[model samples]
Target: MASLAAGASFAIQLFARVGATGTTLLRVGFASLLLIAFWRPWRVRWTGRQLLGVALFGLTLGGMNLTFYLSLRTIPLGVAIAIELLGPLAVAVTFSRRVHDFAWIAMAVAGIALLLPLGGFARTLDPVGLGWALAAGALWAGYIVVGQKVARGHPGPALGLGLLVGALIALPFGVAVAGANLLTPAMLGAGLALAVLSSAVPYSLEMYALRRLPPQTFGVLLSLEPVMGALSGWLFLHQRLAPIQWLAIGCVVIASCGVAAGAAGRAPEPVVGPEPP
Candidate 1:
């Protein structure tokens, strides 16, 4: 539900409401404050290796969101999300041997194919949007892998705070792009609220779920992001959906859900012992 609500918010293009860069800055800024207040990570001291790991996670998170917003400038929210989900889908396929997982991947591929308005190849494409979305998808996969590392290393709030430190580095660029519009109360409020909803809430929820679920199970469930985004886009933006579009979304949801159900009782992959101090 948090992921679905996030898609709805993104469909409104709140960043594009002010400007993508400014919107990114505002969202990160507000989220940083909230995370700092909630987690109080200032007290925690980090070793050099942990600091490097935190920085890596932060960099991936910032890059992912930046590219995603940039993609939204040209692409539909639903389609952009659908493509972004491919990053994880790729990762899942690489790690799994199960034949059913391939079937799920095929469902996702079929859904994405429908996004192309394929009557004539030359006349019907958003090249720039596809470029941005694909770029974002690569970064999204990096973010997930880095996020898992961060989650394992520190408590959530502290890791979240450390990630914010790197996100702040992105502010100058975002401010430059969005500038004065970013300062407007309306934009600030919307961007800040969006940060809480899209980043803060979903991050917390997913972390909670991860703690209780196996990595493969979590990966399977995460595949639902695209389908949820399509539904949220339809409901919140009144984005008109044709029957075929609805069928595409249904296929994604069912395939992902099937993967999740199959993984429910399976043993988690073995956790090797930690390295010696």
Candidate 2:
């Protein structure tokens, strides 16, 4: 989570030079290169179904991230991500068997109400930016579902190759938005670090945690992501929060904690994604 927070903060700062789309493109592009090099995933054969699924996985992953950074141009980074997490949180409880999980749903609903207005979203908010965030969130949820499917069917090396495909799709946009400026060494170095923080560190750390933690506990811990994002923004970016926004963050956190606790002790269920770009 700390890694993810750093990745996002770095993204905001990096975008000042690269532009948001360019930055996302570079990060994912570099990440794919690393995975392909390490896993050498092209050696294996793939079926039509696997290819299609992986293609969709990459598209969703790239699309979600592009939209997210775009949304951050107008919204606060923490707020954008907190809203985005509704995607995964909804996925977690919506597919579960437990009736007790609705508590989490209720908590989520309350949080949304606070962030969105009782009066009017259109009148009070940036509808366009929020709409972009929603698109990213939905894509994020789809990526989780599709990604797990890919991981289950192909497993280890497939994950690496699938990420490469995702990277490929985003490259043109990166070049278009950021242009030849992206090739400069300074941006490349920082972009590489962002990719590592966003991808490698969290990937390894979460895998380790999964061995020791139950799904419910994992869910609860995952809920801390927004808090972590906000903290990193505050500490590094000096992005302050309003009392209302903090309350909304709190409600969502509680709701997610409830969901995690409800699903505790269960064996690992894959809610796979592109290491959370």
Candidate 3:
């Protein structure tokens, strides 16, 4: 979690050099290069089904990163993360049959509502940023589901190949925005660090955990991300949160904890995913 937050911090720092999409491209592109070189996913021949699943995984992963970075342009990192967490929270709630699970859903909804520019809030957040955050959240949900499927195989190869696909997806947009600026020694060096901290290391770890944990449990665990995001933003970016925003973040965090606690005693569900040939 700290790695992911630090990665985001590095990303925020680079936004001035490369636009949002360019930072995303550098992060994903460099990470993909590292993973592909290390894992060499091409060693094995992939069947059509395997390729298709990984394609979906890559698409969602790329989209999620791009939009999340875009949101940081206007929204504070922590606030954006809190709003984005709705994706995994929804995924967590979706898998549960309990009547009380709806309460968690309601809490998350309230958190989002509070972030809206309504009731004459002390400060209004950018709606465009909010929209991007929401889009990131939706794609995050897709990533979690698709990731589970792809990680059931050779997790290393799946991750490497998936990220390669993701880099390709980001290539055009990144090039359009940053042009040759992305290739400078300074930006390249920073991009490498950003890739390692944000994408390569953190995403690899996430894939490891995703394979072992049930979707709901995995989603619940991600609840800590908003806290990490908030801390990173405050410490590194000097972004201060309004009292109401703090309250909103707390609401989501608590809801995440509630969901985790509710699921604690139950027998763990079998991980559901496509078996790799």
Candidate 2 least-lDDT 10 residues: 268-277
Q: Compared with the true structure, what per-residue lDDT tens digits does model 3 show for residues 55-120?
A: 899999999999999999998776688778889878877876777666876776677566544555
Candidates' lDDT values, in order?
A: 0.67, 0.71, 0.83
Q: Choose the strongest candidate by lDDT.
A: 3
Compare candidates 1 and 2 on TM-score and give the better one: 1
Question: Candidate 3, after superposition: displacement of residue 231 in Å?
Answer: 1.2
Give lDDT tens digits, candidate 1, residues 89-179: 7766766668877787677667666654556752545778778778878876776666666565454664466548646866887877877
**CA-only RMSD, every prediction:** 3.6, 4.3, 3.0
Query: Backbone clashes per model, in order?
Result: 0, 1, 0
Task: Score residue 57 of candidate 3 by CA lDDT.
Answer: 92
Task: State the weakest 10-residue window (summed lDDT) of model 1.
Answer: 268-277
The TM-score measured for candidate 1 stands at 0.87
